[model samples]
Target chain A: MNSHDPVSDCPHIAQFGEAALVLDAPGAMDLGAQQRIWALDAALKEQPGIVETGLGMANLLVSFDPDLWQAEALADWLHDAWVRLPPLAIEGRVWEFPVIYGGERGPDLPFVATHAGVTLEEAARMHAARDYIIFAPSVTPGFGYLYGVDPALVLPRKKVPVMVPEPGTVSIGGVQATIGMTPGPSGWYTLGYTTRFRHPFDPHAEPPLQVAVGDRIRFVIEKVLPC
Target chain B: MDNLALSMGNALLGNPDHAAGIEVQTFPMRLTTTQPHLVAVTGAASAFLDGTPLPPCWVMRLEPGQDLVLKRPTTGARSYITVAGGIDVPLVLGSRASDLRNGLGGHEGRDLRDGDLLPVGPAPHSTGAQDFGAQPPDETLAFTSASDFLDIRVVPGPEHGVFTAAAQAAFWQDDWLVSTMADRMGMRLSGEKLTLAQPTELRSGGILPGVVQVPPSGDPLIQLRDANSAGGYPRLGVVIQADMWRAGQARPGTRIRFHRVTTAQAIAARNEQRDLVAALRRDVARYAELPGFTR
Candidate 1:
């Protein structure tokens, strides 16, 4: 049972809209706080009137029926639940992906390396060093936001996002790393691409997603294509 | 999708409110039916069948080989076209709605190209009825604004109080212009730069459609259908669900003004909308016994 103090003068809880409430822990982005949020999400799913729940990087959004619960009362209930609940340590599986760094698959790999004041080889080495924790599910299905990016590779997202045509594109954003599950616009710096897990999301599949939050992900450098 | 408009379109054809319909956003869409069917067009567009002009929010019986054309809307962005039995695309995840980005559900999970055949569900027996019209919900349940700007009702978000007094005042007072970046995902608004009292980079959190998030750029963005499930930008406010249809109709260059309302008021507005839909359902039920009436 690990009890941690929330960031000073933070943990803003209020109505997200007419039917939803959001509890945002405006503190340091860490695993301990996210674990508590996951615990709260699990506990609230069983409660009556709560229609749905979602996880963000370090925040929780709960959708409820307004007729069943008042906005103020629900907000209060969320505060109480968060304080009283214990952190959940999910026993999840670890997945390793073989990745090819640089070349057309990851057009921004050289830029990312240069920005970090490190060579392309060093950047790839730093990125694959740690087993990042799947922080939360992304906007799309299958892939989730991965925590534990090397500090040297930490950089702000591009001012303008470019369209990444390929899925399974390994990219890095501010203090976090993720894999592109679908072709869409992205502001993150693309570092590499992985073919081992090309399509991670399948609607026809029972679970649809093979990985879940609390799972660990490690990337192995399969090959490096010259820029 | 504009739920109210889609529901109304289905109701006009005597179909259930959740029946699958074609959501048309681009202009001058032309289609030819292989069979006779009762068709209804709801939301912003002028519809015509073989050059015979049809009224707005109106439904008509179309004979096979009769071509239908939907011209660009003058007032709104998207229009919904529903048949009697509804578009029978294979349901994915309990919905026929297309996820164009992910390429799942709805017509091969992609845009409907020319000459593509659509499978429509079985319609009811013909009742000899030719045409029926429904009063557009926009006219009956109108959000009145004295100015040219569209008045969208909103509720304060979680981080609403974190903004400076001036920024908060500007948010309510300023008339924001919808930028060209508007799309199904969200709309970027251009107006007074809203800044927080103390700049903070919030950790990503779950966000829903209609949540107004203010990024570092100071311009506020209104999330809409197909919005991301999560975001990191600080939230300013969220447009009420009842008025989301109106917001969805706003095209680029449309002026918008945010009207603040209490949570209770927002819920009350939602109830009003629900009641309106109920009234529409009852009205459509009267024509259900007709041979041409769909389920």
Candidate 2:
């Protein structure tokens, strides 16, 4: 890891607030940038006086106690960490989920198929064919944004969001795919429902999230229920 | 704010055992202690020991079986009760603060219900009644009433330039109303419909409290403490950390206006606020040492 060069992967760091700073990885979302972000998230955790660190799709937010560390020093520390960032070797598990495609389970499946210029069955096959890596948890507890969606199946988000999509609804928006853990408003195009995905947070449970950053996921189509 | 008062109580009582007991929703809850303890009430609420109205931000000693009733604040929305030797709830994620969203922390990861018995940390060897009670300086207390207009300071966000000129102008010029959908997670602000200069799709990224995101609907949402760790919404600006407390105290109908500030200015404001808090802590420590002072 130490043999790796730092200048090529150094991110553009900026101030978020009086006590927090953000390290933004350049370019669109990809595994490389995500790995760099995870590496930096790990590096920041080892620093002294850091209150908390939050990982984003392609960015990392590092918060520190202002009394203990100055803003400039914190920024410098992030730069130093990035320069010495270790090789991306994140340990995670691969979990398989059973999904029901089309019909009432995913009202937007037909819409997504038509938008992507494919038949309903073909859309489901394309979605289930590829393996996805969990980029990071997003929007809700236990909800993860997955990478590796087939570009041919990518679709734009709804102009108006569905106010209460059912929980465990697997959906795609832009180039990313996600699973809804709770019923809430969303703009993603729902393509299926997964029963195997679990709510990632439980207060009494150790390590609240079922999936962490860098985990792998694969969806298997169980059945297509009628709308 | 509760943490600040709890530290003050610990200092005045000469004991490190102190935890903040907060009463949210339907104030004026009564609590009876089994033993004598030093307590202080801060934030947007009033405290009464037995029948005597206790002063806000001042530490008061409670006798055994003495009833303490916390009444709602006339000026603010939340009240904090700091007991010497902090509330003894088993720490979750290394914090005693209740996490309502994840249902962790505090008493069983939930709100303090009626008849709930909270444990307090053991008092240190020097635990004794102080000669003088310490009250926070008036200038140190920042309270906002629902009737008052709020001018919150903000710094431009990463996507601030993507919004149209007119939309940006309206954001700073118009008075936004806090919608009924306000909570610890975030608050929806309704006002001039804000639109972007061009349609853009952003990836989910790290988000912080005070981030003002403008969705396609044009209504701005101010993320709060319990907001999602990351989001894809286009951010217009972020409320300065120093002024976030004001946003937290705002009620549903409160009118809000954004004031743009430079990064340097935001840092300066935060430093100033920290200075005041430090001064208050020092004042409490000094007052507690005065000879022959009593309530």
Candidate 3:
């Protein structure tokens, strides 16, 4: 059920409430660990009494019918399943997005450049240097957090989130980078704006999102606006 | 959704409990209808049709051009209005809920504005008698609460033990005041600064509705329907699913006290609520037997 070996670390599984369970993989955020989580997510959905499963960064949230299953029993089952499950290998498509860095598009570009001891051009280059992997669905539908950001480019998310960030905005928070699927509050530092991006979500579509988890995204430097 | 109020409102009108309805918040909501309609108002708010007061949870007939006003509730914060036929908003993702966060569903994906005309679905051939009355859930499925505090039942969350003993004690015992900064997303509470026994970085995980998460500021936030899918704050407790409606009806400046309950107790409470709705559906069926009301 996985593309890699079974995860060696034991997951911390606990009852969130009467009907939900939260499972946290040990150690830091790792692709291998997250892959295992994806495997678990898919497997649990097939189980009876499981209502829904939500994906998080190296974590999984499961909602179940309390009348059908108890939390203790479910937690025990999840532990056994983790040991038997392997990392899920997703054959995902690659998407390329053109982005404009700095100026009004990216208000925090200068701050990022100054903090990283690099010029604005260098900062933009560093951000667009590598491909990013779509980890999981974020706080909202369709959108997801991207991994593989350069460690030096990482910064803690804002203590308080801004009321609104423009839709299709490209941003970085901690070691993760993401693009805004909709305009909403966010604590991430805006780095650029995706240019002429296609609609990523559609409620009418059978499969709502254009991009799937485990997909790869490349941000191409379309234009760099000066601050 | 305010499940109890919404369901009860529809039930009073001989409609299925799942029918879509208008959710009025902090109301002084007024609507003038152009077509005859059967309507019911549920929750704590009172309603008036053309200056005539209707009892709480009462259903009545509204003629064309009649004015219906939902008065601001002195206690609870929200109300529900159900028509004989559901509100005919185009369903997005199998729901009529206005997803304010994503701006994707219901009434052009935004809040209802003045001059907006809401379309109603076709009603059943027979819509039961008008001027019908039923007991409100607040009176039937009531929870014990003090005059100054709303008592909400909660189940200890996964990270409940991470908080210091004093913090845990204060969480259940103290009457936390609901802050002004509250909305569909969540209600922030101000009270004792809940601290963890040892500071630890928590990976962001899925957030459930009714989860009481503690931010760095130590204030507790009870996540609601529009909350983000995930969060990193440490969760102290979750308001039991059965009591979420009570929390939903709590207005700003209201004091809330969390009552800890076991998983079994939470399930029992949920079942009790379900039984009430089921019984109400059956009880309201009698009006359908009235001559000329047969479907």
Candidate 3 residue pairs that clash: A2-A87
lDDT of 3 by residue, B171-271 (tens): 99998999997888899999899999998667677888999999888999999767778888899998899988888888789999889999899998899
By the lDDT metric, which is better: model 1 or model 2? 1
Q: Give the C-alpha miss distance for residue B241 in model 2, angstroms.
A: 2.0
Q: Would candidate 1 be rated incorrect, acceptable, medium or high by CAPRI criteria?
A: medium
Scored by DockQ, the top model is 1
- The regions of model 2 sitting more than 4 angstroms off are A1-12, A64-91, A163-166, A200-206, B1-18, B124-127, B130-138, B141-147, B293-295
- Alpha-carbon shift of residue B225 in model 1 (angstroms): 0.8
Which residue ranges in model 3 land beyond 4 Å of their true spot?
A1-8, A102-123, A160-164, A182-185, A222-227, B125-127, B290-295
> TM-scores of the models, in the given order?
0.89, 0.87, 0.91
Number of the predicted model whose TM-score against the real structure is largest: 3
User: For all candidates listed, what's the TM-score of chain B alone?
Assistant: 0.94, 0.87, 0.95
Query: Per-residue lDDT for B288 in model 2?
Result: 48
